[model samples]
Target: MPQARLLPAYLVQRYHGWKATTYQDNKSWYRRLAASGQHPRAMVISCCDSRVHVTSIFGADEGEFFIHRNVANLVPPYTPDGQTHGTSAAVEYAVTSLGVAHIVVLGHSNCGGVKGCLDMCSGEAPELLETSSFVGRWMDILRPGYERVKDVDAAFRARALEKQSVLVSIDNLMTFPFVAKAVEEESLTLHGLWTDVGEGGLEQFDPVRGEFLPV
Candidate 1:
C-alpha cells in the first residue's frame, strides 16, 4: 500500500513540511483520479534502482506506465504449470484486463544486479559474491544470459551482459499465452530499452538490426 497516500497528512506534517506545497496543492487530485481508475497505455518492467525511475526516465504522467519493479527486472517465462509469479500476474492484468498495448523491458548500464550475477557465474574469489541474500536470488535470472555471452571478448563483456539480459527478458515474456496472442493478433508490441546514464541516452532494442540504437 502507498503510505504517502494513506497516512493522515497532519500526523507527519512536520517531517514532510518541505513538500507541503505539492502535497496540499495536489491534495485531492490523486484520490479523485485514482478513484476514477487507471488506464495506462503501457506496462513497464524495470529494475528497482534508485537512479532508474520509470516515470522520470520515460517522462510519464501518474498512470502512463503501469510499472512493476524487481531487483533486476527479469521476466520469468509463463507457466500455467502452477508456478507463482507476481511479475507475470501484473503483466496478465495489464494485457488482459487493462488492455495495455505495449510492454517495455528496461535494462540499464552498470547495473549492480547484473554485475553480481556475472561475478557469481565466473567462479570468482568467494569475496566477489555475497550469496544467501535475496539479491542473489534476484540476480539468478541472468544465468541464461550470462552463459550465452561467457566467451565473448573481455572488452565487450559489460555491454554484452546488459544486452543479453534484455533479449532474454523479451524471449521469456513471449512465453505468456496472452503475450503470444497479442503478437499473433499484432495488437501489442514489446520493446526493450537500455539506458546510459553517463550520456543520458536511451537505446531501443532492434532484433533485426541486432543492436541497441538511438530511439
Candidate 2:
C-alpha cells in the first residue's frame, strides 16, 4: 500500500481553529449526538459539485440530514445483483434503517456531469463512451434523461437535461422496493430540485404541472 501523506498545513490549521471555536461551543451537543445517535429526517442525494451545498442551502444542522453526494446526483434503477453499489447502499440504509421521511434529489445548472452526458449522447465526447471510463459507465443512468431532452433547442438542452437528471433520479428511487413501500404507506416522500449555480435560483419539480416551478 502507498504511504499516506499528512494533511496540509492550512487544513490542519483550519481544523484546530474549528476545534477551538465551533467544537468548543457545541461540545455538549456533539457529545449528545454521539451518544444518542443520528435520526435525520431526510436523505439528500445531491451532486458531488462543491458549489451545491446541501446543508447550507437548507440551513441544516449536523445530524438533521443524511446526505449522499454523487456525480450528477443519480440513483440507478434497482439492480439487486449483489454487486458493490454505493448509492443504492446509502438509500437502503436511509430508508430501512434511518427511516428518513423524505428523499431529495438535487440537481443544478452549469453542471459538468450533465454537460458531459449531453456531449456523450450527442457524440461530441467519445472518450466517455469507453468501457474503462468509470464516469461514462456511471453516467449511463442519465441516458434516458438525455433522450427526453435531445430534441430541445441546443441553447436550452443542457439546462433541461439537468432538471431531467433530478426527475430521473426520483423515478429511479421508486424502483427500490423499500422506498416504494415507504412512499405507499405515506411514511416517505420524494422531491426533485434544480438550482442555478450562478444566479442562486432554486426550482422544484411539480408532478401536476410536469415542470419545475420556482421555490
Candidate 3:
C-alpha cells in the first residue's frame, strides 16, 4: 500500500487551534452528534468553488445540512446503468435515508465550471473536448443549459448560464424516481438559488415567474 504523507504543518496547527477552541467549547454537542448521527433537514447542492460558502451563507451549525459539492453544482439526469454515480448516490442517500425535506441547488456568480462549460460548448476550450477530460464530460450535463443562453449578449451570457445551471439541476433532480416520488407525495421540495460572489447578493428562482428575484 502506498504510504500517505502527513498533513501540512499549517493544517495541523489549524486543527489544533480548532480543537482547542470550537471543539472544546462544543464538546457535548459534538458528542451528542456522534452518538445520534446526522439528521439534516436540507440538502445543499453547491459548486466546488471555494468562494461559495454554503454553511456560512445559511449560518448553519454542525449536522444542520447535508451538502454535496461538484462542478457547477450539477445534478445529472438519473441513469441506473450499473455504473458509478457519485452525485446520484448522494441524492439517493439524502432523500431515501436522510429524508431531507428540502433540496437546494446553489449556483454562484463567476463560477469557473460554468465558464468552462460555456467555453467548451463554444469550441474555445478544445482541450476539454478530449475524451479523457473528466471535467469536460461532467460539464456535458450542462449542454442543455448552454443551449438556452447561447444567444444571450456576450456581457451577460456567463451570468445567465450560471443561473440556468441551477435550473437545469433542479429539473434533473426530478428525473430520479426516488426524488420525484418524494416530491409528488409532498415529502420533498426543490429550490434554486444564485449568489453574487463579489457583491454578496442572493437571488432565488421563482417558479411562477420563471425568473430569479433578489432575496
Maximum-lDDT candidate: 3
Of 2 and 3, which scores higher on lDDT?
3
CA lDDT of every candidate = 0.82, 0.95, 0.97
lDDT, candidate 3, 18-113, per-residue tens: 999999999999999999999999999999999999999999999999999999999999999999999999999999999999999999999999
Tens digits of per-residue lDDT, candidate 1, 1-215, equal: 45466557776876587457765778687787679899888999988878887798767767678899886778877767676778889999999999988999998888877877787788763444466566666667788999988999878887789877788889998999889899789999999998886778899988898888998
TM-score of each: 0.84, 0.98, 0.98
**Better by lDDT, candidate 3 or 1:** 3
Residue runs of model 3 more than 4 Å from their true location after superposition: 1-3
TM-score of 1: 0.84
Ranking by lDDT: 3, 2, 1
Clashing pairs in 3: none
Q: What is the lDDT of residue 211 in candidate 2?
A: 97
